[model samples]
Target: MKSVARKLSAVTLVVIALSNGATAFAQSKVTEIPVPNLVIYPGDLIEEGMLTQQRVLKRSIAGMPIHRHEDAILGKEAKRTLIPGHPIALNATREPLIVRRGTLAKLIFREDGLEIIAVVEPLQSGAVGETVKAKNLDTGLQVVGVVQEDGTLLVEGG
Candidate 1:
């Protein structure tokens, strides 16, 4: 009878321990966040098809990644390797580069029937539709221009 009582008490303790572990696990909340469906290479522009919503452990979000369905992710370029199933961090993306810094570019200007194109070099990098400063290589003039998709800079107020 003594041995049976001891075994019963041990079983009760084991049951209590199992229940506590289960309760702890159940208390942990799951968070929904955006994750890449495919590997996004560095400098690759993000598209809607490449992302999916996933529910993950709340504690797993250590770096404060971009939340799913919260912001527009398309048209952004990955600054680093983006792995599948991992949340895309806010710092991991940037605007796509249209004009590379220090690269030879053409400066275009148009007014009525007059159109001019000059050889210039960008002083800084910029994305399409963004304005950046370029140096006219021939005349050593600095001019600000809007970057175009074709990698040409259109000088403003021309």
Candidate 2:
């Protein structure tokens, strides 16, 4: 009778353990998600809390299908996804070049139309109609223009 009781308790414990383990495993399954249409390359920013969908790329890392999410991943505070080719720039530096008023400059033709090539010199105190020459950085063409009060050079190039 004693041996029978011990065996029954052991069996009951095993059954309970198995039942709990099965429930946990079911909850841990990866959920199926949809794929996105946009192209996401490495070094692009990503953020969390944004919707994410998978993408079909020509090639994927480790044979895993590519996934894309909306918005850049919020840095450092979110869970990092180990997707290959996704690089985040933390602290970006580099100030934009600004052209001041009364500076001599040149215009160069570009796909976006004429752009300031360079500033020859900034305007001097009480200098009116300062002469400045600028060469197009892209086309190597030279242009001359006078600076205006709005920090823009008016150049007429052929």
Candidate 3:
């Protein structure tokens, strides 16, 4: 009978320890982050009023760019559907597309304080400030350039 009582005591002690550990974990710090009001579809830019700060457990912040600036993430289009009350994960969104494939794009080359202008047909589509492939219409030479917000492509070193 005494042995059985000791075994029961040990189990009780283990359960108490586990409960205390869980309590400590629950009391850990949490932070508030911006979340959407509704399910945001892909390619929809996030607006300021669309999000509100929500308190979430610190563990959820892991693998997320929680420390990024508001403007850095705001106005970025969602790459996937974002559900309400859940913080948008980093890389879940991107800048809206500015250049489309098979379109004629103004290409600029900046070299040593000299600017050269040319027209190229883009072979691939890309968003503003993203690098994309474009082929020169005249020479048929393929070149890579960053798509500017003003529908211009900035090719480095011609």
Better of 1 and 3 by lDDT: 1
13-68 per-residue lDDT for model 3 (tens digits): 99999999998877675666777778899878888877777877777677676523
Ranking according to TM-score, highest score first? 3, 1, 2
RMSD of each: 7.4, 15.1, 8.2
TM-score, predicted candidate 2 vs. hidden true structure: 0.26
- Model 2: which ten-residue window has the lowest total lDDT? 88-97
lDDT string, candidate 1, 1-158, tens digits: 99999999999999999999998876666767778999999989888789888888777675665655535678888889999988777788888998989889988987776778999999999999899998999889898999999999986442
- Native-referenced Cα lDDT, model 1: 0.85
Clashes of each: 0, 10, 0
Which pairs in model 2 have colliding backbones? 35-54, 42-85, 43-87, 46-72, 46-73, 47-72, 47-73, 47-74, 104-132, 106-134
Candidate 1 regions with alpha-carbon error over 4 angstroms: 1-31, 37-39, 57-67, 111-113
- Give per-residue CA lDDT, model 2, range 1-158, as digits (tens): 99999999999999999999998776554332332223433333433433344433323232443222233233322223333324223222111123543444433223346654453443332122554455544455555555454554566455
Q: Alpha-carbon error at 124 in model 3, in Å?
A: 2.7
